[model samples]
Target: MLPFAIGALRAIVEMLGLCLLGMGAMALLAGAGRQGNPVYRLFELITRAPRQLVARLLPGRERPLLAGVLCFLLLFLLWLALAAWRAALA
Candidate 1:
C-alpha cells in the first residue's frame, strides 16, 4: 500500500513537471509570434487552462513567460522535495 501510494505520487509529480515545462515553453513562444505555427497553436491549446489560471492569479504580471518560469522553478523544487521524501520512505 505504501509503495503504491509513493508510485502514484511520483507519477503525479512527473505529470506536473511536464505540464509546467510545456506551459513555460509555450509562454515563451507567445512573444515571437503566435500565428502560422502549428506547434505554437498546439502548445497554446494544451496549456490554455493553466496559463489562464496563472493570468487570473497575477493580473498585473505583464509577461507570461516570466510567470511560467517562476511556476516551473517552484514546482521543480517541490518535486525534488517529494522525491527525497519518497526515497526516505522507501
Candidate 2:
C-alpha cells in the first residue's frame, strides 16, 4: 500500500510537470505568432481540444493565455482527483 501511494504521488507529479511544460511550449508558440502553423494546429487538435470545446460554449473570442491556464488547472485537478480515488480505493 505504501509503495502504491508513492507510485501514485510520482505519477501525479510527473503529470503536473508535463502539463507545465506543455503550457510553456504553447505560450512560446503563441508568442512566436505560429498559432496558424500546421504543427500548432495539430497540437491544438490533440492537446487543447477540451479548451476549444469550452471556448465554443462560452461568449467572446478565445484567449490563449486564459485557456492555457484553465487547462493547466484542470489537469492539476484531474491529478488530485486521481490521487484521491486511489487513496479511497486503498
Candidate 3:
C-alpha cells in the first residue's frame, strides 16, 4: 500500500512536470496570443496549481514562465524522492 501510494504520487508529479513543459512549448509556439489557443489554455490550467504554489514562494511580479520552470524543478525533486522511497520499500 505504501509503495502504491508513492507510485501514484510519483505519477502525478511526473504528469505535472510534463504539463509544465507542454505549457512552455505552447507559449513559445503561440507567442503573445497563447491565451486564445485551446491547447495552450489546457496546459496552463493543468499547471496553474504548481505555478501558484511557486508564486507564493517567489514573492513579487507575475512571471508565469519562471514560476513554471521552478515548479517543474520542484516536481522533479519530489518525483525523485518518491522513487527513492519506493525503492527502499521494495
Badly placed stretches (over 4 Å) of model 2 are: 1-20, 33-42
**Candidate 3 Cα deviation (angstroms), residue 4:** 0.7
Ranking according to lDDT, highest score first: 3, 1, 2
Model 3 Cα RMSD, 1 decimal:
1.1
In candidate 3, what are the lDDT values of residues 1-90, reduced to their tens digit?
888889998999999999888888887888899889898888888888778989889876588667878889999999999999999999
lDDT for position 34 in model 3:
85
Expressed as tens digits, the lDDT of each residue in 1-90 for candidate 1 is 776776787776566568667645655667556555676566566556656666667757687766666656655776787778778888
Better of 2 and 3 by TM-score: 3
Model 1 clash pairs are none
True-vs-predicted CA distance for residue 36, candidate 1, Å? 4.7
Worst 10 residues of 1 by lDDT: 27-36
Show where candidate 1 strays beyond 4 Å.
22-31, 34-38, 45-59
lDDT for predicted candidate 1 compared with the true structure: 0.66
Angstrom error of the Cα, residue 39, model 3: value is 1.4
- Backbone clash total for model 2 is 0
- Return whichever of 1 and 3 wins on lDDT: 3
Better of 1 and 2 by lDDT: 1
Candidate 3: stretches off by over 4 Å: none
